[model samples]
Target: MGVTAVLGECARIFTHPRMIFKLAQRELNVDISTDAYIDENRNIEQTIRADERFYLELLVIQAADEEPSTHKIEMYFITYCRKLSHNREASTGPDWRDDRQWIPGINMDNGYFQMHEYQAPAWAQHLNHIPSHIVKLTTLNTPIHRWSLPGVPDRFQVFIKRDDLSGAELSGSKVRILQFLFAEALRQNARHVVTGGCLQSNHCRSVALTCRQFGLTPHIVVARVSKKEELEAKGNALLYRLAGSHLYLSPTCSYESFSQRLRSLAGYISDKYREPCYCIPLGGSSPPGMFAFITLFQELIEQGLFDNFDDIVVSIATGCTAAGIAVGNYLTGSKLRIHAVSIALSKEELTKRIDLMLSDIGLSLGTNDIMDIIDGYIGQGYETITNVSANTGILLDPYYTGKGTQGLLEELKKNPTTFQGKKILFIHTGGKFGLFNGEMDQVMNLPGNHANYINEWPEKDIPLVQ
Candidate 1:
């Protein structure tokens, strides 16, 4: 007879002796010694204390079939484990200076148990957002292609998985973030959603679009752009206006002040209209927001994307996405390397931020191996683009998939042997719409040879005589 069962919260100890003994007796029908002495000195509690939510691991253990087999015949079980906890306050966040001392949390430990089966919603069963005809060009489906740079070896095959192409107005990483935000808003019965970002924020645009989709009004607080700027009408800003989103411009206000202002405005609107308003932090870098990427990881697994790659690279902005991806990777036991490229924060600051995020998700590092923190690409600060990045953007955007590609180029150049024959996938998070606000001109000045294209082409009808 075959035994198959789903375990909830007990899969964390897939390799534990006690777990093995129990499985052998229950599933294999083997008479294992119940009085067998087991070592209790294992710091299982400490390990579990590092990451509470990560305590859940899905395990599939099977006993092979044989004639009169000592082991069971084709017995398999999938279980989840909850790590034990010391119940201590988690460390403030990750330590940027010390990679060796970093510890992830273990708060969700209650021991592994079976999960109850649940049916999918009728509406959810028939819903399909991604078109069936468009082949998903991800790391799992296609071989990564390398972009050649001077002095970089062709052996470095760095391919970008275009998460940016998810949609036109709803393009980029923020789309996934907005999916969760809208779901939560609907759950809370919110009539209006409020958020703030820079003058050219893709996140802000996504929030506006999501609000429109869910029949909720969006109120956006934006910082004023400099008057000297030549704005483009084809990017995210244009889309936001077209979506009929309400915009509020803030001049000479600090981030804290701007947040306070939004709160005050929300209160006034709520009082006036008697409708509930939902406020999201800048860039949607909150705990619930991080679940967007976690859910993405789940989708990737169901699609079998994790089976092909040994490492995954993502462009890090606020660090929430990176943390979520890391936690998801850990939970799934995909064992893929997560290389995060710092775009805004420093190596130290990013580490701390990710650590805090993981803590919020009930997971911890706690002297265990966590994701690799790679900094070195953050040219100046958030939104600051370097000459190389500009060139990359020109080559890769409209597509907004170049900064991470550039970083991958540098990484491959620095250590060609690291990727020797391994496949690498770069997550192309969307920000092309943000780039459309004439910001690229300020960051990436056009070459003198190309100046004629922009300046002389409109005026001159004929080519200049050589």
Candidate 2:
């Protein structure tokens, strides 16, 4: 039966003076006072219609009720309840179900809401808040480790946020960003995902792995750093291959060219698959992706690490992650200093990009006092820094985190007064797999020992018992 028919039948069957009695109908089963019934009814209807899967399951239960078999009816009812519970938990988080936070209400300023109370509307261009969603693909809450690294200023304490362990193959800041991007793709019923990055781009690999995990086909257009490097599948490229991603190589490495290529590739994929194609910008630095770090700030608040840091340092390329962090700080009214160490973009460029990103979320750098862009770390250009460093004893990718750490150390040495009495938290955005690529030759230059090296081995293999 149609939803209206079902609801009307419920109203007729419940026949009571008070509207609260109508809520006891089997389809709803909500217990609320008469005063709350109007608001509750609107919320209940919204919640029920939010997910089509839930509505379909309810219809299935309704259909099974007419069947003669009681066991079959119970099975359908149980299935519907399980789905309801799972969706509820995913939407409202751990134990905030009674609050009906998943039900979107009209915000006074924006006329939109989110699944979580902490999240604003995803696309709301308002002056109040940013956004987050519940399409979790990997486990988050990477532990923060305190560091006592050499050469750091005496009065400054350092902590590293281990985002490297965010997932197995999907580890890094990209995964957090992908959670929202892929969620939007799924909402659009997209069957193909089109994205681009460098040959060993960690972002591309993370997207490929996430797409495979979500039963979607990934098409990656990898911009070539070198002809030789393009020929080899190493680091993130290896993961792309293993994840069954359709790989394409582009000669241009510039973001503008890369975006144009992505658009063409997306069109091709849509035509080929006879399905919709979702294109994620380079580094997944879209507005939705920016929310990843905004939500991350929320996570840090929960961990009690929010107020403890005087400065938060991150290696920024496209600058979306840093922008999100800045927005979070601005929204929360915190005076946390956000250090965006440039990996590729210049100080002026980074500032402009970050300013634009902030403006996208109804925030501006002029009004927001959280942004601090530290450049001069783009040593030997963007593609030249292939030799990864381990100053923090954590596996920081050569592209982002390594350069960022180097910059942080140098900044500490040069300007001791700035970080003298402050606490610094460096974000370790993981790119461990990038070390396995052709860049290993450059990294192994000073090393006599390797991970595969053995101290001693038997002269002959032992025979099998069988």
Candidate 3:
């Protein structure tokens, strides 16, 4: 049907407000009078229709913020639709005529405006379960684009979600989780934000930067292998010094020990400063932080990325990001299998951490049911480089994204049936700063590729003429 015909019919059928308010998800919001609504709906609907390639799901309802008014009653027209392009067969979107799928705001034989509350299905309502108050720390809706792997089969399709571009300094999936963590920290009127991690930890860097932005002192409890490692200021450690973060270096690297130290440090700071100190757990992977990925899953659904990918792979350190995504997938009844490569902990230990995180969020899904924990890729240890050669030209750190992506590629090559011909999305969790930790010295010293270099700027003797 034409845009004008649909909107005109809408006006005649609904016995309610004169103004037609349109809200496009994550985009436009406009309040139009009857004449303006008619004129503008044509352009908006035509843009939305996209030559019938997209089917617009329009929901007409009374504005929940407003009460009934005689002169004018506010009616909202919400537009929602999923993009239809994937390796799998495309889905013909919902049929508007199907009454079961939608509840239209229409009143017959009554001139008075009526309010009809649209109750989303249980799965749809799952998106609303995140923590309400959140600090906007990272850039969201990061682009998801197709990626080219070196040795992948022709049939298989790979995509990368660029969570690494979330922010300049606050880059990575850690910043997303920290959004919730720091929000809670500020809410508690905290003077010092205490967190724990290793020497060159990305999580520690993110926490420190966020604390500086929030005008709170960042106290980082770092687990160190040696005193020299603690003394060296490089990579994320340099950022900690730049942000004026207080570092507490400890010899014990145990998670329990780190937690105890963080609590003790926060308590001491509280007593010394005579102010509240908020202690964020290691990697900010707590119940409050898990909401970051849960909400990110909702963003995927809105962007039409949820239905396209069959499997999602990510690197797991503390297991909070994986748990959040898995919970969101389980709640939405998605068939996507979540695969997490263990960057630090063993499969058993990481699974235990994930299980506990889920339990804190009131979910009780077993490891097998929620995600596929892929181990055997820890290499020498955490923050160490793996020897897998699956170069895709994308900048991934040696710590997290590099290890996780190499694991996925090895799986696709070794056991093709597991992921062959399946659309896969790999989440780049971001640890770019860790690359400068002197791990790639041999590779950097090796012979460089001289074929790409050309003398494009020939001496430029004429430049002095200016």
**Which residue pairs does candidate 3 place in steric collision?**
none
lDDT of 3 by residue, 1-466 (tens): 3333334444543322132233222212433345633442221221222322222223322222233232121122222212222211211222121222123464332321111222233453444334544556655889899887665667678899989898788888888777677656655656578897888899989988777665577888878645654466788888977888877778876788778888999899889877678999888877766777877788787867666888888898888888878777888888888888888899889877787777666675676688888888876322223232223456777778878877887788786676523899888888888877776654543344221233466566647556
Better of 1 and 2 by lDDT: 2
Alpha-carbon shift of residue 317 in model 2 (angstroms): 0.7
Error of 2 at 82 (Å): 19
Off by over 4 Å in 1: 1-152, 224-234, 251-264, 366-369, 380-400, 415-421, 442-466
What stretches of model 3 exceed 4 Å from their correct place? 1-130, 225-229, 380-392, 447-466
| Candidate lDDT values, in order | 0.53, 0.64, 0.64
Error of 1 at 346 (Å): 2.0
Model 1 scores worst on lDDT over the 10 consecutive residues at: 130-139
lDDT digits (tens) for residues 21-107 of candidate 1: 455455556563533333443211111212322322212233323222211211222212111212212112221111121112342
lDDT digits (tens) for residues 261-289 of candidate 2: 89888998888767678999888887887
- Arranged by TM-score with the best first, the candidates are 2, 3, 1
The residue pairs that clash in candidate 2, if any, are none
* Candidate topping TM-score: 2
